[model samples]
Target: MFEVEVKYRVPNHDAIRDRLKALNAKFLEHTEETDIYLNSPLRDFAKTDEALRVRVYGDGTVVLTYKGPRIGNVGKTREELSVTANDLDSLLEILRRLDFREVAKVVKRRDIYNYENFTIYLDTVEDLGSFVEVETMVNDKELINRATDEVLQFGDKLGLKREWIEKRTYLELVLERGNERR
Candidate 1:
């Protein structure tokens, strides 16, 4: 599937949560996520704008995801393939044996909400402060552009300003912060 989303840096989630309540958005579960990012030995995923991740949720569920390079200039649109993993240690061992090296670990608490056709994610990232992500998934590649527009429009409807929109991924932000500190 293609994941079409836009992320915004916000001071806090209070305003967005109120707006979501006003819109009668359905509240989903709140969960903490630990994402482990890996790098391929053969290529530089950072240069290619691709990602491989192992996500362990607070409920003990584990997921393996491969995200392709970003497709368009409008939004953070990409082809995402994901599957559930039964064993996190075994999966990490397999990836390590295959020469995939761990690059970064990101932890965040996420509150999910559903309004209309969009899944809204309110995230409080470790060390990175708060963010809101508006996202939708589409199976057809042709629908990506339209989906991107809709995601942005939905964010605007929720009082998210375009100026606050952030195109960088959490991992990128973390890496940049590390570089700045060094």
Candidate 2:
């Protein structure tokens, strides 16, 4: 699976949300996510087109997403990856193990998402600004190049960057900024 995403420097998030509503779309749920970006001893991500992610924790609790199908805060998405071990009840039981800094459910929407396959997903986040994603299920070098190029195009169109992209999770973003003020 592959993920192609870009974070835009939103001017007026509320205004964007309002405009999205006029288009007959909505976010899914606001989920506060805590991510641990690992270090790869092998390659330079700055120039690479592919990334590998493994479900270390919350394997059963959270649905792992590979393809993001959403444009704008109103964009929709479909789960490209779902990790279910035994049963829903048993799954929920395992979710109880990992520690999360913050968990905000996404506010879903009904718009459009395009990738190797078409899918619709939801997104509603808090203290992290409005964002969208697009992923594809391809790992080949050629495919990764294509997908990464596509994502970069969107990022360029939106005037985003690999730098401005928040490397830290939202919970960390909040805390990092808060600590900066002190």
Q: What is the C-alpha lDDT of each candidate?
A: 0.95, 0.38
Any residue pairs clashing in model 1, and if so which? none
Where is the poorest 10-residue window by lDDT in model 1? 71-80
Q: Compared with the true structure, what per-residue lDDT tens digits does model 2 show for residues 1-182?
A: 44334434343345434433554443444333323222234553223422222222233343333323332321121224544334544433433444211222322222243333322222344544554443344544345555556655544443444454433333335556667879
lDDT tens digits, residues 1-182, model 1? 89999999998999999999999999998999999999999999999999999999999999999999999986789899999999999999999999999999999999999998899999999989999999999999999989999999999999999999999999999999889999
TM-score of each: 0.98, 0.42
Off by over 4 Å in 1: none
> Which candidate leads the pack in TM-score?
1
lDDT of 2 at 12: 35
Worst 10 residues of 2 by lDDT: 100-109
Error of 1 at 177 (Å): 0.7
State the displacement of the C-alpha of residue 134, model 1, in Å, after optimal TM-score superposition.
0.2
